[model samples]
Target: MIKKLLLTFSFLAVSMLLAQKNNDQQTVDEASEKLRLAMISGDKTVLESLILPELTYGHSGGHIDDAKEFVEKLVSKKSNFLTIENTNQSIQIVDKTAIVRNHLFAQTHDFGKEQGEVSLDILYVWQKTKNGWKLLARQAVKAEKKK
Candidate 1:
Protein backbone atom coordinates (compact mmCIF):
# COMPACT_ATOMS: atom_id res chain seq x y z
CA MET A 1 0.00 0.00 0.00
CA ILE A 2 2.84 2.36 0.84
CA LYS A 3 4.53 1.61 -2.50
CA LYS A 4 1.31 2.38 -4.38
CA LEU A 5 0.92 5.71 -2.63
CA LEU A 6 4.47 6.65 -3.43
CA LEU A 7 3.99 5.84 -7.09
CA THR A 8 0.83 7.91 -7.31
CA PHE A 9 2.46 10.92 -5.67
CA SER A 10 5.43 10.69 -7.98
CA PHE A 11 3.17 10.57 -11.02
CA LEU A 12 1.24 13.59 -9.85
CA ALA A 13 4.42 15.57 -9.22
CA VAL A 14 5.76 14.81 -12.66
CA SER A 15 2.44 15.72 -14.24
CA MET A 16 2.42 19.05 -12.43
CA LEU A 17 5.92 19.86 -13.66
CA LEU A 18 4.98 19.10 -17.27
CA ALA A 19 1.92 21.29 -16.98
CA GLN A 20 3.99 24.21 -15.73
CA LYS A 21 6.30 23.94 -18.69
CA ASN A 22 3.38 23.86 -21.08
CA ASN A 23 1.92 26.94 -19.47
CA ASP A 24 5.17 28.82 -19.81
CA GLN A 25 5.45 27.88 -23.46
CA GLN A 26 1.91 29.07 -24.04
CA THR A 27 2.65 32.44 -22.48
CA VAL A 28 5.70 32.98 -24.63
CA ASP A 29 3.84 31.96 -27.76
CA GLU A 30 1.08 34.43 -27.04
CA ALA A 31 3.59 37.23 -26.58
CA SER A 32 5.21 36.39 -29.89
CA GLU A 33 1.91 36.59 -31.72
CA LYS A 34 1.10 39.89 -30.07
CA LEU A 35 4.39 41.31 -31.26
CA ARG A 36 3.74 40.20 -34.83
CA LEU A 37 0.35 41.89 -34.86
CA ALA A 38 1.74 45.01 -33.24
CA MET A 39 4.32 45.35 -35.96
CA ILE A 40 1.72 45.25 -38.70
CA SER A 41 -0.58 47.59 -36.81
CA GLY A 42 2.25 49.88 -35.74
CA ASP A 43 0.96 49.79 -32.17
CA LYS A 44 3.63 51.57 -30.20
CA THR A 45 2.01 51.00 -26.84
CA VAL A 46 1.83 47.26 -27.26
CA LEU A 47 5.33 47.16 -28.68
CA GLU A 48 6.73 49.03 -25.69
CA SER A 49 4.92 46.76 -23.28
CA LEU A 50 6.44 43.68 -24.84
CA ILE A 51 10.09 44.72 -24.97
CA LEU A 52 12.63 45.22 -22.21
CA PRO A 53 14.12 48.63 -21.43
CA GLU A 54 17.54 47.45 -22.58
CA LEU A 55 16.58 45.75 -25.80
CA THR A 56 19.10 45.02 -28.51
CA TYR A 57 17.39 44.52 -31.85
CA GLY A 58 19.62 43.47 -34.71
CA HIS A 59 18.67 43.59 -38.37
CA SER A 60 19.78 41.15 -41.04
CA GLY A 61 21.70 43.84 -42.88
CA GLY A 62 24.17 44.39 -40.02
CA HIS A 63 22.23 47.25 -38.47
CA ILE A 64 21.18 47.37 -34.84
CA ASP A 65 18.36 49.16 -33.05
CA ASP A 66 18.21 49.98 -29.39
CA ALA A 67 14.94 49.88 -27.47
CA LYS A 68 14.07 53.52 -28.06
CA GLU A 69 15.14 53.48 -31.68
CA PHE A 70 13.26 50.26 -32.32
CA VAL A 71 10.00 51.75 -31.12
CA GLU A 72 10.53 55.14 -32.65
CA LYS A 73 11.21 53.70 -36.06
CA LEU A 74 7.81 52.08 -36.08
CA VAL A 75 5.91 54.81 -34.25
CA SER A 76 7.40 57.61 -36.31
CA LYS A 77 6.79 56.04 -39.72
CA LYS A 78 10.46 55.49 -40.34
CA SER A 79 9.79 51.75 -40.48
CA ASN A 80 6.57 50.13 -41.53
CA PHE A 81 5.63 46.48 -41.84
CA LEU A 82 2.93 46.19 -44.45
CA THR A 83 2.55 42.49 -43.82
CA ILE A 84 4.26 39.96 -41.59
CA GLU A 85 4.26 36.20 -41.75
CA ASN A 86 6.05 33.68 -39.59
CA THR A 87 6.83 30.01 -40.09
CA ASN A 88 8.33 27.17 -38.07
CA GLN A 89 8.23 29.09 -34.81
CA SER A 90 9.59 27.31 -31.79
CA ILE A 91 9.87 28.11 -28.09
CA GLN A 92 12.17 26.52 -25.53
CA ILE A 93 11.76 27.43 -21.91
CA VAL A 94 14.64 27.23 -19.46
CA ASP A 95 13.88 28.34 -15.92
CA LYS A 96 13.14 32.09 -15.90
CA THR A 97 14.19 32.56 -19.50
CA ALA A 98 12.90 31.40 -22.88
CA ILE A 99 14.47 31.23 -26.31
CA VAL A 100 12.31 31.59 -29.39
CA ARG A 101 13.15 31.07 -33.04
CA ASN A 102 11.13 31.71 -36.14
CA HIS A 103 11.35 32.42 -39.82
CA LEU A 104 9.98 35.83 -40.72
CA PHE A 105 8.76 36.95 -44.10
CA ALA A 106 7.74 40.56 -44.38
CA GLN A 107 6.98 43.34 -46.77
CA THR A 108 8.50 46.42 -45.28
CA HIS A 109 9.49 50.01 -46.01
CA ASP A 110 12.36 50.95 -43.75
CA PHE A 111 13.18 54.59 -43.36
CA GLY A 112 10.64 55.01 -46.14
CA LYS A 113 13.50 54.21 -48.51
CA GLU A 114 14.13 50.63 -49.70
CA GLN A 115 12.48 47.76 -51.62
CA GLY A 116 12.31 45.99 -48.29
CA GLU A 117 10.92 42.54 -48.91
CA VAL A 118 12.90 40.29 -46.61
CA SER A 119 13.05 36.78 -45.23
CA LEU A 120 14.91 36.34 -41.98
CA ASP A 121 15.69 33.75 -39.34
CA ILE A 122 15.16 35.45 -36.00
CA LEU A 123 16.11 34.55 -32.44
CA TYR A 124 14.51 36.24 -29.47
CA VAL A 125 15.38 35.95 -25.82
CA TRP A 126 12.67 36.59 -23.27
CA GLN A 127 12.88 36.90 -19.53
CA LYS A 128 10.13 36.32 -16.99
CA THR A 129 9.71 39.55 -15.07
CA LYS A 130 7.44 41.02 -12.45
CA ASN A 131 5.45 42.61 -15.26
CA GLY A 132 5.39 39.25 -17.08
CA TRP A 133 7.53 38.05 -19.98
CA LYS A 134 9.54 40.84 -21.59
CA LEU A 135 11.63 40.46 -24.74
CA LEU A 136 15.27 41.08 -23.85
CA ALA A 137 17.11 40.86 -27.14
CA ARG A 138 16.65 39.85 -30.75
CA GLN A 139 19.02 39.01 -33.57
CA ALA A 140 18.04 38.32 -37.15
CA VAL A 141 19.95 36.96 -40.11
CA LYS A 142 18.87 37.13 -43.71
CA ALA A 143 17.45 33.88 -45.02
CA GLU A 144 17.95 32.66 -48.52
CA LYS A 145 14.85 32.67 -50.67
CA LYS A 146 13.08 29.34 -50.48
CA LYS A 147 12.60 27.61 -53.75
Candidate 2:
Protein backbone atom coordinates (compact mmCIF):
# COMPACT_ATOMS: atom_id res chain seq x y z
CA MET A 1 0.00 0.00 0.00
CA ILE A 2 2.78 2.39 0.95
CA LYS A 3 4.68 1.59 -2.24
CA LYS A 4 1.59 2.18 -4.35
CA LEU A 5 1.03 5.53 -2.64
CA LEU A 6 4.63 6.50 -3.31
CA LEU A 7 4.32 5.61 -6.96
CA THR A 8 1.14 7.57 -7.32
CA PHE A 9 2.69 10.61 -5.70
CA SER A 10 5.69 10.44 -7.95
CA PHE A 11 3.50 10.22 -11.01
CA LEU A 12 1.49 13.18 -9.86
CA ALA A 13 4.61 15.24 -9.29
CA VAL A 14 5.94 14.45 -12.74
CA SER A 15 2.59 15.29 -14.31
CA MET A 16 2.51 18.61 -12.52
CA LEU A 17 5.99 19.44 -13.74
CA LEU A 18 5.02 18.65 -17.30
CA ALA A 19 1.92 20.79 -17.03
CA GLN A 20 3.97 23.73 -15.80
CA LYS A 21 6.36 23.30 -18.69
CA ASN A 22 3.53 23.30 -21.19
CA ASN A 23 2.04 26.42 -19.63
CA ASP A 24 5.34 28.25 -19.88
CA GLN A 25 5.68 27.29 -23.53
CA GLN A 26 2.14 28.52 -24.24
CA THR A 27 2.91 31.85 -22.62
CA VAL A 28 6.03 32.24 -24.71
CA ASP A 29 4.13 31.42 -27.88
CA GLU A 30 1.47 33.98 -27.11
CA ALA A 31 4.10 36.59 -26.42
CA SER A 32 5.86 35.83 -29.68
CA GLU A 33 2.61 36.12 -31.66
CA LYS A 34 1.92 39.46 -29.99
CA LEU A 35 5.36 40.69 -30.99
CA ARG A 36 4.75 39.65 -34.57
CA LEU A 37 1.47 41.50 -34.61
CA ALA A 38 3.08 44.59 -33.12
CA MET A 39 5.75 44.53 -35.79
CA ILE A 40 3.18 44.19 -38.52
CA SER A 41 1.10 47.04 -37.13
CA GLY A 42 4.09 49.30 -36.50
CA ASP A 43 2.99 49.78 -32.90
CA LYS A 44 6.14 50.86 -31.14
CA THR A 45 4.66 50.75 -27.68
CA VAL A 46 3.52 47.17 -28.07
CA LEU A 47 6.89 46.26 -29.47
CA GLU A 48 8.59 47.91 -26.53
CA SER A 49 6.42 46.03 -24.08
CA LEU A 50 7.46 42.72 -25.61
CA ILE A 51 11.19 43.46 -25.68
CA LEU A 52 13.59 43.40 -22.82
CA PRO A 53 14.96 46.69 -21.57
CA GLU A 54 18.37 46.04 -23.10
CA LEU A 55 17.56 44.36 -26.40
CA THR A 56 20.06 43.45 -29.08
CA TYR A 57 19.07 43.23 -32.71
CA GLY A 58 21.37 41.79 -35.35
CA HIS A 59 20.72 42.40 -39.01
CA SER A 60 21.56 40.01 -41.80
CA GLY A 61 23.89 42.56 -43.36
CA GLY A 62 25.97 42.67 -40.15
CA HIS A 63 24.25 45.77 -38.86
CA ILE A 64 23.14 45.89 -35.23
CA ASP A 65 20.20 47.72 -33.71
CA ASP A 66 20.10 48.41 -30.05
CA ALA A 67 16.94 49.00 -28.07
CA LYS A 68 17.14 52.80 -28.21
CA GLU A 69 17.86 52.99 -31.91
CA PHE A 70 15.12 50.54 -32.76
CA VAL A 71 12.54 52.38 -30.73
CA GLU A 72 13.60 55.78 -31.96
CA LYS A 73 13.24 54.75 -35.58
CA LEU A 74 9.70 53.62 -34.89
CA VAL A 75 8.77 56.82 -33.08
CA SER A 76 10.24 58.95 -35.84
CA LYS A 77 8.30 57.03 -38.49
CA LYS A 78 11.50 56.35 -40.31
CA SER A 79 10.67 52.68 -40.69
CA ASN A 80 7.50 51.00 -41.81
CA PHE A 81 6.64 47.36 -42.22
CA LEU A 82 3.42 46.33 -43.95
CA THR A 83 1.74 43.17 -45.13
CA ILE A 84 3.86 41.10 -42.81
CA GLU A 85 3.50 37.35 -42.77
CA ASN A 86 5.17 34.67 -40.69
CA THR A 87 5.71 31.01 -41.36
CA ASN A 88 7.59 27.96 -40.11
CA GLN A 89 7.59 29.17 -36.53
CA SER A 90 9.18 26.89 -33.98
CA ILE A 91 9.90 27.46 -30.34
CA GLN A 92 12.12 25.71 -27.84
CA ILE A 93 12.19 26.40 -24.17
CA VAL A 94 15.12 25.88 -21.84
CA ASP A 95 14.53 26.52 -18.18
CA LYS A 96 13.51 30.18 -17.98
CA THR A 97 14.29 31.16 -21.54
CA ALA A 98 12.87 30.41 -24.93
CA ILE A 99 14.16 30.65 -28.51
CA VAL A 100 11.78 31.18 -31.39
CA ARG A 101 12.71 30.85 -35.05
CA ASN A 102 10.54 31.77 -38.00
CA HIS A 103 10.47 32.81 -41.60
CA LEU A 104 9.09 36.29 -42.28
CA PHE A 105 7.79 37.88 -45.44
CA ALA A 106 6.93 41.53 -45.38
CA GLN A 107 6.66 44.58 -47.55
CA THR A 108 8.61 47.28 -45.82
CA HIS A 109 9.61 50.84 -46.65
CA ASP A 110 12.47 51.77 -44.43
CA PHE A 111 13.34 55.42 -44.04
CA GLY A 112 10.84 56.09 -46.82
CA LYS A 113 13.58 55.06 -49.20
CA GLU A 114 14.15 51.33 -49.36
CA GLN A 115 10.93 49.56 -50.26
CA GLY A 116 10.56 45.96 -51.25
CA GLU A 117 9.19 42.57 -50.35
CA VAL A 118 11.66 41.31 -47.77
CA SER A 119 12.08 37.72 -46.76
CA LEU A 120 13.83 37.11 -43.49
CA ASP A 121 14.82 34.31 -41.16
CA ILE A 122 14.25 35.60 -37.67
CA LEU A 123 15.52 34.37 -34.33
CA TYR A 124 14.05 35.70 -31.14
CA VAL A 125 15.37 35.04 -27.65
CA TRP A 126 12.90 35.48 -24.85
CA GLN A 127 13.61 35.41 -21.14
CA LYS A 128 11.04 34.72 -18.48
CA THR A 129 10.68 37.90 -16.51
CA LYS A 130 8.92 38.88 -13.32
CA ASN A 131 6.26 40.55 -15.39
CA GLY A 132 6.28 37.82 -18.03
CA TRP A 133 8.37 36.72 -20.98
CA LYS A 134 10.22 39.56 -22.70
CA LEU A 135 12.37 39.38 -25.78
CA LEU A 136 16.06 39.79 -25.13
CA ALA A 137 17.50 39.50 -28.59
CA ARG A 138 16.40 39.36 -32.20
CA GLN A 139 18.50 38.46 -35.21
CA ALA A 140 17.27 38.67 -38.78
CA VAL A 141 18.82 37.08 -41.82
CA LYS A 142 17.65 38.22 -45.19
CA ALA A 143 16.68 35.38 -47.45
CA GLU A 144 18.53 35.27 -50.71
CA LYS A 145 16.56 35.10 -53.90
CA LYS A 146 16.84 31.85 -55.69
CA LYS A 147 17.94 32.38 -59.25
Candidate 3:
Protein backbone atom coordinates (compact mmCIF):
# COMPACT_ATOMS: atom_id res chain seq x y z
CA MET A 1 0.00 0.00 0.00
CA ILE A 2 2.83 2.39 0.87
CA LYS A 3 4.60 1.60 -2.42
CA LYS A 4 1.43 2.44 -4.37
CA LEU A 5 1.05 5.77 -2.57
CA LEU A 6 4.66 6.69 -3.32
CA LEU A 7 4.21 5.95 -6.99
CA THR A 8 1.01 7.98 -7.11
CA PHE A 9 2.70 10.94 -5.44
CA SER A 10 5.62 10.79 -7.84
CA PHE A 11 3.24 10.76 -10.77
CA LEU A 12 1.32 13.69 -9.43
CA ALA A 13 4.50 15.70 -8.93
CA VAL A 14 5.63 15.04 -12.49
CA SER A 15 2.19 15.96 -13.83
CA MET A 16 2.23 19.25 -11.97
CA LEU A 17 5.66 20.16 -13.28
CA LEU A 18 4.63 19.43 -16.84
CA ALA A 19 1.49 21.52 -16.48
CA GLN A 20 3.45 24.49 -15.17
CA LYS A 21 5.95 24.32 -17.99
CA ASN A 22 3.20 24.11 -20.56
CA ASN A 23 1.49 27.11 -19.05
CA ASP A 24 4.68 29.12 -19.20
CA GLN A 25 5.21 28.12 -22.80
CA GLN A 26 1.72 29.28 -23.65
CA THR A 27 2.34 32.63 -22.04
CA VAL A 28 5.47 33.26 -24.09
CA ASP A 29 3.75 32.17 -27.28
CA GLU A 30 0.89 34.57 -26.67
CA ALA A 31 3.33 37.39 -26.02
CA SER A 32 5.13 36.71 -29.30
CA GLU A 33 1.88 36.89 -31.26
CA LYS A 34 1.02 40.14 -29.57
CA LEU A 35 4.40 41.54 -30.58
CA ARG A 36 3.85 40.65 -34.22
CA LEU A 37 0.45 42.31 -34.32
CA ALA A 38 1.73 45.36 -32.52
CA MET A 39 4.56 45.83 -35.00
CA ILE A 40 2.18 45.53 -37.93
CA SER A 41 -0.10 48.12 -36.42
CA GLY A 42 2.69 50.38 -35.10
CA ASP A 43 1.23 50.27 -31.63
CA LYS A 44 3.72 52.00 -29.33
CA THR A 45 1.95 51.04 -26.13
CA VAL A 46 2.07 47.37 -26.93
CA LEU A 47 5.62 47.63 -28.25
CA GLU A 48 6.80 49.30 -25.08
CA SER A 49 5.18 46.56 -23.04
CA LEU A 50 6.95 43.89 -25.07
CA ILE A 51 10.46 45.30 -25.35
CA LEU A 52 12.97 45.87 -22.60
CA PRO A 53 14.50 49.29 -22.00
CA GLU A 54 17.93 47.90 -22.80
CA LEU A 55 16.89 46.19 -25.98
CA THR A 56 19.48 45.67 -28.70
CA TYR A 57 17.72 45.29 -32.02
CA GLY A 58 19.91 44.38 -34.98
CA HIS A 59 18.93 44.32 -38.63
CA SER A 60 20.12 42.12 -41.46
CA GLY A 61 21.64 45.13 -43.17
CA GLY A 62 24.14 45.49 -40.34
CA HIS A 63 22.51 48.33 -38.46
CA ILE A 64 21.93 48.00 -34.75
CA ASP A 65 19.51 50.14 -32.82
CA ASP A 66 19.06 50.51 -29.11
CA ALA A 67 15.60 50.53 -27.57
CA LYS A 68 15.05 54.28 -27.82
CA GLU A 69 16.20 54.56 -31.41
CA PHE A 70 14.19 51.53 -32.42
CA VAL A 71 11.01 52.75 -30.77
CA GLU A 72 11.43 56.26 -32.05
CA LYS A 73 11.83 55.09 -35.63
CA LEU A 74 8.71 52.96 -35.37
CA VAL A 75 6.62 55.62 -33.72
CA SER A 76 7.67 58.40 -36.09
CA LYS A 77 6.74 56.57 -39.30
CA LYS A 78 10.39 56.24 -40.19
CA SER A 79 9.78 52.54 -39.86
CA ASN A 80 6.34 51.26 -40.77
CA PHE A 81 5.54 47.61 -41.01
CA LEU A 82 2.76 46.77 -43.41
CA THR A 83 2.76 43.08 -42.60
CA ILE A 84 4.68 40.54 -40.55
CA GLU A 85 4.24 36.86 -41.34
CA ASN A 86 6.09 34.03 -39.71
CA THR A 87 6.98 31.10 -41.91
CA ASN A 88 8.25 28.99 -39.02
CA GLN A 89 9.15 29.57 -35.40
CA SER A 90 10.38 27.80 -32.30
CA ILE A 91 10.76 28.88 -28.69
CA GLN A 92 12.84 27.23 -25.99
CA ILE A 93 12.76 28.35 -22.40
CA VAL A 94 15.47 27.91 -19.78
CA ASP A 95 14.84 29.21 -16.32
CA LYS A 96 14.00 32.91 -16.68
CA THR A 97 14.95 33.31 -20.33
CA ALA A 98 13.46 32.14 -23.60
CA ILE A 99 15.30 31.88 -26.94
CA VAL A 100 13.25 32.17 -30.09
CA ARG A 101 14.06 31.40 -33.72
CA ASN A 102 11.82 32.62 -36.48
CA HIS A 103 11.76 32.63 -40.27
CA LEU A 104 9.75 35.67 -41.21
CA PHE A 105 8.42 37.43 -44.31
CA ALA A 106 7.58 41.06 -43.95
CA GLN A 107 6.58 44.14 -45.93
CA THR A 108 7.11 47.73 -44.91
CA HIS A 109 6.61 51.30 -46.00
CA ASP A 110 9.28 53.46 -44.54
CA PHE A 111 10.34 57.15 -44.74
CA GLY A 112 6.74 58.03 -45.33
CA LYS A 113 6.28 56.23 -48.64
CA GLU A 114 9.33 54.15 -49.50
CA GLN A 115 8.24 50.50 -49.76
CA GLY A 116 10.38 47.52 -48.81
CA GLU A 117 10.14 43.82 -48.12
CA VAL A 118 12.22 41.13 -46.49
CA SER A 119 12.54 37.43 -45.83
CA LEU A 120 14.68 36.96 -42.77
CA ASP A 121 15.82 34.65 -40.03
CA ILE A 122 15.44 36.23 -36.61
CA LEU A 123 16.76 35.24 -33.21
CA TYR A 124 15.10 36.78 -30.20
CA VAL A 125 15.97 36.59 -26.54
CA TRP A 126 13.22 37.19 -24.00
CA GLN A 127 13.68 37.59 -20.27
CA LYS A 128 10.96 36.94 -17.75
CA THR A 129 10.65 39.94 -15.45
CA LYS A 130 8.23 41.28 -12.86
CA ASN A 131 6.20 42.95 -15.60
CA GLY A 132 6.21 39.73 -17.64
CA TRP A 133 8.30 38.59 -20.62
CA LYS A 134 10.14 41.40 -22.40
CA LEU A 135 12.29 41.09 -25.48
CA LEU A 136 15.88 41.70 -24.50
CA ALA A 137 17.57 41.44 -27.87
CA ARG A 138 17.07 40.46 -31.49
CA GLN A 139 19.30 39.74 -34.48
CA ALA A 140 17.99 39.40 -38.00
CA VAL A 141 19.73 37.98 -41.10
CA LYS A 142 18.17 38.42 -44.46
CA ALA A 143 17.68 35.19 -46.39
CA GLU A 144 18.33 34.73 -50.08
CA LYS A 145 15.19 34.75 -52.18
CA LYS A 146 14.20 31.47 -53.73
CA LYS A 147 13.80 31.35 -57.46
Model 1 TM-score (2 dp): 0.92
RMSD (Cα, Å) of model 3: 1.7
Candidate 1, residues 38-121, lDDT tens digits: the string is 988878999999999999999888899999999998888688888889899999999989999999998888664885788899
TM-score of each: 0.92, 0.90, 0.90
How many clashes would you count in candidate 2? Answer: 0
lDDT of 2 by residue, 1-147 (tens): 999999999999999989988999899989988877776676878888888878998878888889877777766657677667778888888999999999888787777586877788999999999989999999999885322
Q: Give the clashing residue pairs of candidate 3, or none.
A: none
Arrange candidates by TM-score, highest first: which order? 1, 3, 2
lDDT of each: 0.91, 0.84, 0.88
* Most accurate candidate by lDDT: 1
- Cα lDDT of candidate 3 equals 0.88
Model 3, 89-135: lDDT tens digits are 88888988999898888888887587988889999999999988899
Deviation from native of the Cα of residue 38 in model 2, angstroms: 1.4
The local lDDT score (0 to 100) that residue 95 gets in candidate 3 is: 85
- On TM-score, the leading prediction is 1
